[model samples]
Target: MPDGPHTAPAATPPLCEEEIARFVVERFLPGVDTGDLDPEYDLLATAVIDSLGVLHIVGWLSKQYGIVLPDRELASRNFRSVRTILATAERAAAVGAQP
Candidate 1:
């Protein structure tokens, strides 16, 4: 009733590596300290994320950002580090923003 258009604002800001790290630590690794997480840390190399964990992260991202990742994009490289995940999320958000 107030304007020509009414669009919902994003629930959260553009995803960043630090925030992704915090998400990973809090949601996936409950006991892990935030300080222990590095933006460039190799989650897979360190056994931080196993096969099942990858699925969990994928599900979380889909729900959190309304993203739909393709099977080709679900490679280990994309989920290797928080930095990479942040980049992937940003890309997905950009794509989702288009009309």
Candidate 2:
């Protein structure tokens, strides 16, 4: 046997673009298929999400990812697209995991 056995690294909470897309389509754009939602779609430009919707999304993110979103992360830019939202959530979760 080897002196030290290898072990898997701690798994970070995954923030996937598909998951974000599914949430957005379900919550804000009912009847819209997730397949139609592109990664770079302009959710704000298309009126998919408003200020109140943004708050709802922020709340969902905080609860789902177990991270308190910083005030700066509440910006609409962070939720502009599926890619952006996933990136922001992943970043926030990573930061929140630190001591």
Candidate 3:
């Protein structure tokens, strides 16, 4: 893992929870209130992000990892925290890898 603001991993696999958190905070949360953007932060409740932002994240995951997430899977549980996001991404990646 390359240090200094990790985005989705390129060679290895999908981004992990910690890397997702760093990416979201460093890339997406800039100019937003940092006080409410903790690791366990409820992104929806805090209004730290919206539905469009979740779509943006989904797009990024697809582009970066070739994991396309369908609209039906886009829910608050999947995008609520870094852990959840990584889990969702991993699931998508696994599905993509299947023959």
Q: Which lDDT tens digits does candidate 1 get at residues 1-99? A: 776788897676445666678889987789988878878999999998987887888888887767777787788888998988877767776777889
Candidate number with the higher TM-score (1 or 3): 1
lDDT of 3 at 41: 74
lDDT for 75 (candidate 1): 85
| Candidate 2 error regions (>4 Å) | 1-13
How many pairs collide in each candidate, listed in order?
A: 0, 0, 0
Could you tell me which residue pairs clash in candidate 1?
none
List ranges where model 3 is wrong by over 4 Å.
1-14, 31-38
lDDT of 2 at 23: 87
Task: Give the per-residue lDDT of model 2 (tens digit) for 1-99.
Answer: 879988996775467888789889999889989999999998887888888888888888877766677888888998888888888887787888899
TM-score list, all predictions? 0.76, 0.80, 0.71
* lDDT-sorted candidate list, best first: 2, 1, 3
